[model samples]
Target chain A: MAEFKKADSMLEWFDQRLGVVNFVKVMMTEYWIPKNINFLWAMGVLLTVLFTFLVVSGIFLLMYYKPDVNMAFDSVNYTIMQEVAYGWLFRHIHAVGASVVFLVIYIHMFTGIYYGSYKKGREMIWVSGMLLFMLFSAEGFSGYMLPWGQMSYWAAYVITEIFGGIPVIGDELVVWIRGNFYVSDSTLTRFFMLHVLLIPLAIIGAIVFHFYALRFPHVNNEEGEFFDFDEEAKKYLAGNKKESKVVPFWPVFLSKDFFVLGFFMLFFFYLVFFHYNFAMDPVNFDKADGLKTPAHIYPEWYFLWSYEVLRGFFFEIAGVSGKDLGLMAFGFANAIFLVLPWLDRSPMVKPANQRPYFKYWFWFLMADLIVLTVYGKLPPTGANAWVGFASSMTFLALFIALPFITKAEAKKVGGK
Target chain B: MKEFKILAVIAALVGITYYGIEPYAHHIMHPEVAPADFSFKTLKNVDTTLAGNAENGKVLVEANCIACHAIDKAGYPAIMPNADAAASYGVVPPDLSSSGRIYDKNYLANFIFDPVSAMHLEGKYTPESGKQFPMPAYNWMSPQEIMDIVAYLQSVTPKVTEGKETNKATFEAACGRCHDMKYAGIQATTPKDNLKAYMGATPPDLSQYIKSRGEHYLHSFVNDPQVLLHGTSMPRVGLTEKAQEEVIAYMEEIGDSKKAERESLGIWVMLYTFVFAILAYLWKRKIWSEVH
Candidate 1:
């Protein structure tokens, strides 16, 4: 039996039973992150701040929020917005947190891409991060349905219906997922369960896995300068830190992260208070009616780029339907992010600055996503249809062109 | 410089998307429907500044308007119950108790002179279209007679109190006829089915309207719906400037009650974050100075 021996202090007693001393040393003091890393590296911690915002605000909303089709609208719009004191503030923080989380996620993802942080041994960190991104997207979409507004109802209906476009188990899959033939009370209840519980738990798991994964390869930094952590940690431990090329994760690295977080909160709370409408769609204020559809319907800004890709294929060609083909393309777009490590053949261990071809690819991908997002919000008719289709093709073409460009870049790696 | 370049690219990409594409796309999709008759330029002869004897105005209103609208504040009742009125007119006739306070004096006179033309419903309520307006034109009445009736309605309706609950009075007078405020326990006076038939769509409850339709859009659309939706059946209620403001403010009170709290709290939160940001920066500089 592991018996706790009486010690000089409570801390020493706990450290004897649990390896608290070693745990802290391993996780914080001994763990190293690159010193040369820029402020963009702070995005991961900023995402944690956003998650905390959503969780805390979500708990307050859940106290009053009903999941029924009829009651959900009143619960959110009337009880929370009107009756409960400062309910509007909680709702605003949550809605804004859900939206801004993605803004940071995209930056985090793009930052990874720019620095080739997903290269070689660090693939698991990127993969785990993408998993969290996917989980967060699900979390956001499900929570959106809890409002039971026109946009909420229809967005749910539209997204769930997209699953019906799959090949064999399509129709049945849609029914099972919705728990009804159409989006009804059952759909709302199940979505409510996933939103408040199941998916969020999964996201927590993924975030834990992501942080755990980061410990392995450690964090890749701004210039993609590789460091032997074991070797550098000794120098850091010996108090000769100037030449260590690394800093401890806790006090040294986190100081910059907290600074970035404070700055981020300034922008966040400004939107939470003054510019709230950017997150809350006006249409969502109207109670959900299955019979009535809004004149213009689209996902939130974060999902618009991928949604545009889904809507981009406007025509049926080569026997397959456009709807089915678009679904396939959308699926590919989502899955492609997880496979970036295997696709880029470049042997570079540096930022996009040091690699010319990969840098262009990164910018092109950014611009194409912007174009897709812009065209996504517009009604897919006339010129929009053509541009959206071209942009959709470009999105897919970027991934296809990845190995080709990077393979060529491998030849230039040694010269640099 | 490289980091700065990266930040520039991000800012430019975001700017082009939000400021450039988003607004442009919305402008094209939902073109700003400028108010067509904000000044009510269609009615030229509605001169409300004319003097009228309250006694004469009361007599005229009793003779004509009391048959349909119950001016209960003035001790007049409609000749029929609400159901019978709804069955006959396809909607319950609104009580005229607060007409003097809520409706603009010019609009009241114009509405009586020609119901269809005053509301710009000439396109819908035409002889060829067979869609008769519920309220018939009182064109036979002299201009002086119409003005007298309007004056009588105004005089009979009690003056809205200066500061207290004036908002509620204006809201009830302007919108209580067709819309339900379920959260406040104020059901629509007219039946939903009757309203649906009358206006081609039932008026939505106003409890969450401030949140649903933003403050600016609500003001514009309430003043004139036809500008935003060309074929909308909602008639221009023609509220006076003060009455309109009161009603919109009342909607905000019910729908967005925490607005004051939110704004006040926002100031503190913003200041806290800003101050913390500066402190964090200083701390980071000190900590990093120890690092290298």
Candidate 2:
């Protein structure tokens, strides 16, 4: 085994016994990272830190939370907020952390696309990330239900009701997901298990695989330059090179990541302490009532884009329900993002800044997302529905037409 | 110098965050004050020197209220069914079993003296024009007699054993005649048109009143409806101090049983969080020092 010097006597002893020093050096300290990567690159590290906060704070909240349907709201509003020590802080951190996590993940995903991080050898890492995101969505949806507030109950009902639109086993699946005919005690219990235990374990497993896949590839850079680490290392060992653009992850990337993490923490703590209920629906403070539905039932802002897609269709087409088709469209809107790497068939693996057309299309997609988010909160009326349908169609069109557009743009530019 | 800068920035941020959150935290810690219009002096001019007799008040309530209201779980057949009352008075009279838990003494006494004047209903509609509310002025009753009746109404506790009977009497006597009790399975038997004609709008269900309106607001409103709402038809029941206490108790018992527990535990929870936050900050600094 190759040996690396350990500075501390205690660490050296542990390294000899368990190879701890080598593992840390290889995975972190000695790891090569692109020097030019900007703050966007720090998102992955920030996300990991945020996840840790969520899991730790979540465990504390779980200590006081009762998942029973009748007791869920009281347990959160009364017992957790009022009975347990620092329960309000933990509960707020966990709840608000979920939103911040999504915010960070969205930026992280966008950064990956902007830098073509998902191309070639990084496909597996990207796919794993997508899988992690799906798990996150599931975890978030289930956690939202644990509060059992008016919005929680209705959101669960509306989202799960979409499954009932499927042909054949649709009705059964909805019933199965809910554990009954409605969002009841059984649903709350199962969702509690998913939110606190099952989904988190799955997320951790996915993250492990994600990092394992990420380790082999040199991290993507803003210049979209691919550095072959083996070749670079061979040259250095042979004395053909004294220095390289590739920098050690420890002092360079880690410092940047920590600085960004500190800034994020400052903002995160601000939200947790001050504006904890920012963007939170006021109606959710009321306890769940199955019979008394609020006039406007909307999902959390994060889920609004897909929710708007679901609302775009109101009329039945041919023999099928438009809503069922809308459900399919919503599923497709999310599922299409997973296959984005394949859809963009551009030969050049370059940053979006270098690809004008791709940049334009990416901005279009972002605009579509923002519009959908805004429209999702509005009542699905005549003009809004038409606008939603048009934008949703454009959203799909941009993705489907990506390969052709990229090919044509590449031909015109006369470059790979 | 770099370390100092970083530390100073963090300290500044911490200070800002603390200052930013102080006002909201203070608001949460303190009791909320109602708007000036909703506020009223409680039992100010009433002679509290005369102690109320619950037993005597009960007799007076039986004589005065039973004609229009029912205050028992056995569902005493009302003398005027909701429909007849609605037809005669425009709005059906409310039940009174839980009134003791809902109203304070001074407002109740003032209301009993002159229902129309107390409710500020004199200019809104007139009896000569057949647009007046049904509740008659009880100004003829002495302050002591009114206090006794208030004491009797307040003494009637809702039967919680059946769960549904928890607010049955107070609700029937004060609010049930017009408003529906969805949770308790009681429906208003008043004709829809009569309610519309009399009250301008059909009364909303009151099962969730205490949860929605809160105790302090209810006290002021029940004492004098017009003080909080300029033209509400709900007349003052003229309750005294003891009666008011009992009524407020019932409302609290039914609506917010966990309130005291919630409030008492909150300060300790905040304290624990403050300590935990300090520990978390130290741990975070320790871990991040590896990279720095």
Off by over 4 Å in 2: A1-9, A231-243, B1-134, B137-292
Residue-by-residue lDDT tens digits, candidate 2, B1-292: 5445534743563354333323432343333545333223543434545677888987787778778766654254556766677776666666665556555555656566666655556756676766645667677887788888777766774534423343444445555556665444567667767766666676765444565555666777665566666666655555444444454555555444445654455555455655655655565455434423
lDDT of 2 by residue, A186-243 (tens): 9999999998889999999999999888887768877888778766655534544335
Residues B124-146, candidate 1, lDDT per residue (tens digit)? 77689778988888889888888
Q: TM-scores of the models, in the given order?
A: 0.96, 0.66
Model 2 - which docking category? incorrect
By TM-score, the best candidate is 1
In model 2, the Cα lDDT at residue A410 comes to 76
True-vs-predicted CA distance for residue B2, candidate 1, Å: 5.5
Question: DockQ: which candidate is best?
Answer: 1
lDDT of 2: 0.71
In terms of lDDT, model 1 sits at 0.86
Report model 1's TM-score to 2 decimal places. 0.96
